[model samples]
Target: MRRPGSGTRRLAGARVPVRVRGRGRDHGSAAVEYLGFLPLLLLVALAGVQLGLAAYAAQQAGTAARAAARTAAQRERADGAEQAGRAAVSAWVAQRSTIGGTGGCPGDAVTVTVTVTIPSVFPGVDAFGPVHRSATMPCDESN
Candidate 1:
């Protein structure tokens, strides 16, 4: 049908303009979405860091156990055996690992057991518990 603009004015009066509905262009939509998801990203990053730290601690524990066992097996049950082992591994660890035990690793067949309590990066969350790493080495029987 010819509209009034085309010189045909019949049906209704002047045609009412159709209003565009719904939402307009969201200029800040991406920014808003990223802001909403930032917290989750940060949490994941912190968890990753915590996992790395735990793994490092576990490796250090194993190193300490091996070193202690080797030293104690051949040594004369000296007082510095345990301290040396603890220091050797603490060089890599966070200096917070609890390393100590009786001179049980001073026999022909020495066994050193290292235990470390993993620290948490996130509060109130314990992903990995205490880790225990042990090593045993035969003594130098030749004295």
Candidate 2:
């Protein structure tokens, strides 16, 4: 016979109910809920990463533009402005970037424009567009 208030009940020739400590009907519910919410969490994380990538791409574009403009401002280095721009950014960004502008010391200033495609964290998704940045530098007449 089980003691009173022991959290067990027994009927005639029937199984008894045993109560486990620190366990209830809601046991493992949190895990189930977490599983249900896992997708959303991952999506948020990916979105944050994608945002960071886009920002980095924009920054890289600006850097590339400045570098190209600086190089183009010098008549002697004008021919290598595009190369300098590509070399200013990360290889991955450089591979997906385009640099163009007016150089030649013909004008008082040299302008360079750089475009970098924003990378995606998810494959087959290209919703994020390219980032464009432009920079201008005074031409060096001597060079």
Candidate 3:
């Protein structure tokens, strides 16, 4: 108990200590993480796409080579071989894909080549030069 006009300890007279609690500061954490991981993510995605494209080009090349060989054996005409190879590649791949045929029938193996434009998703990389695929098959005995 305190008397009047005397400064005594009271409930209101005691200083209330303030302890400030706040959430941890995260300034652009997500952005920083994304920036750090962006290159890896892009590399993986690009590699997957490139591998798929390469497989597809290889399949097209095989198909074209087989078809050209068959055509060379049957028709024994160079034009027919070229046409067959082009047809086979065009049926499965884009028109931009290239198809070339060489060689002859009767002891000659027909060669078919397929080429495609590699996508340049990566910076400062040439994706168009080494994109060629080739396959060769022996002509049948008919021609």
Candidate 4:
């Protein structure tokens, strides 16, 4: 008996509610909440990436150190310990990584150290220091 969308449904003497609202006071606030939380989301993502980079750097350092020690342990390969270590790692990492060694096979054992800078996920951020790993191998009898 009422016209379509008459804009109002007036009863005898009271005005009827025309617009339906959600039961909660914060209805339709999903978009606003997400926008407000965007910074936190970005921060978490960057932290995850940075963590991965640090782990990778540590692993690379270990690998390089082991390779260097092994090479140095061999009398024939002692001269190329550092080079062997560098060759064992990825080019990018080797470029940024530093290699060192001490206690050669000439004495009793060979030890090598690898230090790799932790790459950053965010530009211009170098808050992290280098990852270090050391390896030692018994010297070959010939050495």
For model 1, residues 41-110, the per-residue Cα lDDT tens digits are 9999998999898988888998888777767776566445577678777554636565555265445676
Name the best candidate (by lDDT).
Answer: 2
Q: List the candidates' TM-scores in order.
A: 0.73, 0.83, 0.57, 0.80
Of 2 and 4, the candidate ahead on TM-score is 2
Across 1-143, the per-residue lDDT of candidate 2 in tens digits comes to 85443465577977678665555567899999999999999999999999999999999999999999999898887899999999988999999999989455688998888989898899999878899899989999784
- Tens-place lDDT per residue, model 3, 55-91, is 6666676676666666765544755776777787655
* Cα RMSD (angstroms) for every candidate in the order listed: 6.2, 4.6, 8.7, 3.8
lDDT of each: 0.72, 0.88, 0.64, 0.85
| Worst 10-residue lDDT window, candidate 2 | 2-11
Residue pairs in collision within model 1: none
- Clashing residue pair totals per candidate (backbone < 3 A): 0, 0, 0, 0
**TM-score top scorer:** 2
**Candidate that beats the other on TM-score, 1 or 2, i.e. the better one:** 2
Winner on lDDT (1 vs 2): 2
Misplaced by over 4 Å in model 3 are 1-24, 76-78, 91-103, 108-143
How close to the true structure is residue 89 of candidate 3, measured as C-alpha lDDT?
Answer: 68
Angstrom error at residue 124, model 4: 2.9
Ordered from best to worst TM-score, the candidate numbers read: 2, 4, 1, 3
lDDT of 1 at 85: 71
Stronger candidate by lDDT (1 vs 3): 1
Flag regions of model 1 displaced more than 4 Å: 1-24, 91-94, 100-107
